[model samples]
Target chain A: MKCYYHPDREAVAVCSVCGKPLCAECAQEYKGKVYCKECLAKVKEEEEVAASKSNVSKGDASKSGASEGVVPKSAVSEHTETSSTESKAKKEVPYKGASTAKVVFTSIVVALVIIGLILLSTMGISGVLTPLSLVTSKSSSVESVTAIPYEGERSITVSLDANNCMLNVKELENAIDDKVVKENTEGAKLAVLTSVNTASRMSYKNGTLTVKATGLKKNAVVNLYLTIRIKEVSLESDVKNASFSISLPDIPISAKLSLTNGGISLSNCTVDRINGTIMNGSVTIKNSGVTGIYLKGMNSQISFSDNKFLGNVSLNLLNGTLDVKGNKHIASFYEKGVNSVINCDFSKTEPPMSATFKNITTEVTINVGKQPAVISAPYADVKADSYFTVNGSNYTTPNYSKQYSCLDISVLPAGETAIPLGSITLLGGD
Target chain B: MSDIDARYMLGSILLSLGIVYILSNVTANFSPFWGFIGIFLIFEGSYYTVKYVFRQHKDITNPLVTLFLGIAVLIFTFHIVIPTFTMLVAGFSIAVGAALLLSGFVFKISRKEVLSGLILIGFGFLIATPAVFNISEKFYRYLHIYGVGALLILLGLVLMIPRNKKSVKKDEGGKSDEVH
Candidate 1:
């Protein structure tokens, strides 16, 4: 084969399938017109109706562009006679191919969607989201918080009508290195401003830190942190206890937090594991993705809004209740107790999670799909009723172990009432 | 076959091979028969692609179709491959840690994402961490029904409910209202 670089003569080559003189510069390639210059242009003017056409029902849009200007009037010769029905059927093909092309694109998008779902489930969605730090102002005070930010020291500002500044932690450390990040500061120059009035007071140990400030004046600010590896850090404030405001950036880790007394708030926090207690305080968790989580409280009801969950989740109540609304679901739940009530609408959830409960003193009314998958408590008493509901498959655990179905029954002799949980066996599975 | 065509075919073949290989790796339960099936499909795809470009320089199979199938195959592989691959990555990360420990300042120059870098390191630990719990009371509340219903359903009703009881508005003042 001699090379003809942009020659005027139509470059021809042998077709691989049928040894025909195929014109390069106008050769048919891909699924389109890639032919000799002149013939390629001609092919463009008139697509081979016979070649691309297949048997599919199509309207008469074919005669528009190509056929009219395609074949030279003098060269109006038809070759390779096709069956009349075949030809008609063939005419439908190019259009079918066009439709098929669209379907192929759709299939691609769908495949991508399915793959994305798989990846999300397995790889664990990136804990990466905007920091949950938010500045909000009420009549006199505002609060903001973040969890698992950077490993080093971080600072945040809060609004309250108490002390000018409160120290959250005097010493903080990185879990990996156990490096001392923050330390004691006597009369440390704190930011001027805010509600409460108190001098900076702090004490630190291996993994615990204590900061105290009372009589907070308006416009004061306090900085908070895990303080240490956060072995067990508790933020509880009474009427006189100084309020702590936390702030940090998004950390790609999971955390289990417990709260009592004062309000605990956090934003943009993602967790893989958690079991928390809230009593006599409000817990506000936002933008957090959890695999398995539980929040239980009495007297002080806990509510979660704008939360995302991935796996098994449940809330039990002996006195107060729990409420949550957001974009996620429970794998399953099992509940039991009197006066304790379980209510959930499974239709709003993504996964098909359900619950089973032996409502002793519980009044359970949870919604799954359209029907209410609820079971009521036996006692139905106001005082001793316990109610529980969760999103997970039921499994019979060790007969002695307390099957989470009972909300208020803590004193029962251990027997064979264990519920086996087996649906989500994966690490992140509920 | 045109060099450009052959190169395109090669690229597609490589991509398809990657998908096939990944699929092979992740399957929890794999049979030699399925492996052969996957191999055959990939090889068949590659073979036709090469032959088309080399012999005829025209693709007989639709590229879009082939691309879709390849992606599906890759996803199938990802589901199977990642769990095992996680270990490999974990080991590699440990090695990197060792290297970093040894070559501290040397690696500091890649300060491009040092903040993110530290967070990621912690996150890796987080991924391996077991959950923690504290003494707790438990309550379950799905109280948004009233709010959601009020905002969504009742709001819709309110929006649809006209403020005007029976008064014809200025725009509604028609040409003729006289009854014969």
Candidate 2:
């Protein structure tokens, strides 16, 4: 028989209540019998009304019984006496199925919404990160690079002048040319200072090495490959629009590194005297130690960790970020910057350390170690979130002001230094 | 008003506004949902209006007219090939209309009352003519809104009233054929 709802489709079952032929999609089963959508809806409505009426009567009966201090059988009987002929007929033919059309339609809508969301997210991500691939492509090209093994320990002065190329320095028993790229762009030739591909030059003169590369076009890109190793070496570079990544072994060295429009990365080297400068790029110094260090930068970031400064460290930056962590010890740490942020964690410092950090229009945070010291920040708000002692009074929550600008705080009883012009936040106790 | 009346009134208003918003946002899309809500409002409104208004007075022309017109509008709006708005409205209008007509006969009403019911059925059939004859889209659209809106308002008014317990019991008694 054809379905009552869909005449084109065959009827899978007949609604027991309404006696209508129903297709599989429209058929609903309840109590072991098939029913159509309309019959199911009717049965549900009737059941709900009956149930609600019964509940109301039951509640009324209970309330009356409680007030009269006796059990009321009227409400109970009202529910039990619902054995009408019509209700009996409805109960007798209780086998029916629920409708599925609503379910199918809802599922289709939800699926479409999910698909649209996924497409939108993918398109948004690709649109934002489209041009980031040019900076990382072809950045490692080297030519005329030779390696000479070291015979004995000797002092070396390494000067690398890469005008538009990366400079890398490492420590080994031999010196090898760490040239990055050898590219030949159309209608542009490099002024090769040394006999090398692409006008890039490098020559060792009287224990002083100078490397230079020039001539660049707008659309022309060149990958500079510089992987050289010199033990006890001094590396210098005055580069414009070039980045550097230097990694050397633990050796005593004097180095002055300078760059104009690129970032610098230095790791795993111990220096006697090291000074560096950068413009418009970040500086990353990690896992290294120095006796006396002086560094300056403009529009760049400076991050360092896991090293010790035996003598003193002075760093100046303009519009930059300074992140330092895991220092062994420093005799004195001084920093000056403008429109920048200094985020430092000195929770692992040895005793008797003095630090001074000053900035303008900047936000600074210094997490101090377990040493007694005086913290002073005049023009900024200072709140002691942890327990500390100031002027012989111990406090867990203390406020500092002009009358009480100087604060002596420490987890341990040892006062040796002071810091000024930065918000100092102690680690943990909070 | 009682809390239950206030709740029901608020619910009706919110649901009506929600339905109208959904319809206005995308009239063509989600037609099934729209139709379902429209039929529900029609039936619920018709039932409450008829039950309460007729309970107070057995012979009231307003409720009878509303009942007849609501059913007729449902028949016209729905009546598709599937068990969509078409079947739902058809079954509801036919069942409710037949019940009222039979009740009228059982009560042995006046000639005017009988004629009123017959006229209601005739109007219902007439309303269905647009769909049957594939009339102008503009006429069909106008009929759809007026039909659904009228029923919804009538039902909303019904739900807004606080249901009296004794009145409900009288309705149940009337349904069991306790009175002619």
Candidate 3:
């Protein structure tokens, strides 16, 4: 069987004290005694506590003897046994206590080591563990220093397979420049920056821009910077590991931006159909306008703020946050995911603001401008304002789904929204 | 090596670090297959510590401390125990370094101990440096699989040489294994 401590390794022996299986690397021996690391630590702690207690008792015994002018029988006997056995043990095991200075010095070393490790651990956790933590900081940052001139191109598609890239779609430039600034780490021998169209397999036709920056070697951190004109852009990125900061201009066109293993920061754009696919990154759309929205991804956050959607909205998230706020208009909303959350707060929405949701072990909350005309959920534990009816009966608080098989909630004058067994809350209207 | 406490502590540290480093390299696609060999060296180091260096001593505090440290490193490295393993490691290292610096003043100061403590503090700072600042531009270019693999191989070779083979046969440090 695999070791109890290390799932990948075989167990060499069971700990003598704890009876837990241990790998060879995790086993410890103390002068012909075999034990697991945990047992050894416990034994060590007990011994220190015992030693300190003995010292205190001895001091007390000496003080009592001085005050009474007589040696305590128990103290004398114990002292004799300790001296004899300890002397014998010392010969068998030549363990000596270092000077006070040495002990202090070692302790200091150990303490420092711990402190240093803590700090480093924090850095690793923040940067490597949570790649989505950069969502808020880089929400609206459109660092577009170099923009490629577009000669009246009606539609454009750019594809990139890069280690790290920041491609921005801004206003049309006066001139087209293919020059790009490359940021590379020290051991980046295999990381190469090239135009995706010329990289053998990728192709780009007229009115298409493709750039690829790939780290040819493992653990190679490469950065590619590019700025292109905002048009009917379709971006398909298949990156091993990278981050994208893209900004589409105020133009009326359909746009599709997809990423594989990075985060996307899209800011200020108006599109007919905005289809964004984020496989292992976050989606941050700020102050943008879209008619149709389709987002699908996992292990990242999807956030929208101060946006207007004139068409349908479909979101599919596996395990992350879905936050939408300040949407003035949306035709219909359809969302489905597992271990996901949908938080929407719309101050104002056009007529027929309908939504359908399906989730498992999810949390969803919608704050609407007006109470919906129809709200129906069969298996969910809902808490809504008392202005509706459940299966033709007056809606009541502190109610369970078991009592009534059918349920329906309606506001005086609004739309209808339906949700499933997930934990969903609807709140709005005075 | 004959000092059991020292051996146990050193062995635990090396083993934990070796496993973590190898895993990181493998996941990052840096070392791949070659990383396994480094783990063997770490295992060998642990074996040496338990077999020859460790002994029943007057107190077991330091060795126990070391074991706990090993476990802590594993937690921070894998991030299994918590989210954001890297950040946890950074914070822990800084706290440990500061504690060590203060501990030096608690007891009689030994130059060797002081130096070791300082080095540990410095190493902790180094680990935390990348996230806190941007000093990695020059270092990333030279930090590929080959360099890490080579270093692991060197360490493994060194460990296999058996620093105190003669001392292992003898129970005491003063004994010589030479035959007249």
DockQ of each: 0.03, 0.01, 0.02
> What residue runs in model 3 are displaced by over 4 Å at the alpha carbon?
A1-231, A252-261, A274-277, A371-373, A378-430, B1-180
Q: Is the docking of candidate 3 incorrect, acceptable, medium or high quality?
A: incorrect
Candidate 1, residue A253: how far the Cα is off, in Å: 6.6
Error (Å) of candidate 1 at residue B57 is 99
**Root-mean-square deviation per candidate:** 27.1, 31.5, 25.5
Better of 1 and 2 by DockQ: 1
lDDT per residue as tens, model 2, B1-180: 334334544654465456444432322111334343543444334433433332322233443434444333333322212122433454455545554564466543556656555665555455545433433233555768697898899999998987645422245446532321
lDDT of 1 at A390: 37
Tens digits of per-residue lDDT, candidate 3, A256-369, equal 544456665666666667675566677777777767879876566888777766467787776778887776666677666555666766545544566665543444565554
Ranking by lDDT: 2, 3, 1
- Highest DockQ against the true fold, candidate: 1
**Candidate 2 overall lDDT versus native:** 0.48
Q: What is the lDDT of candidate 3?
A: 0.47
Off by over 4 Å in 2: A1-231, A369-372, A376-430, B1-180
Better of 1 and 3 by TM-score: 3
Assign candidate 2 its CAPRI class: incorrect
Candidate 2 local Cα displacement, residue A78, angstroms: 99
TM-score of chain A of each: 0.36, 0.41, 0.41
Best by TM-score: 3
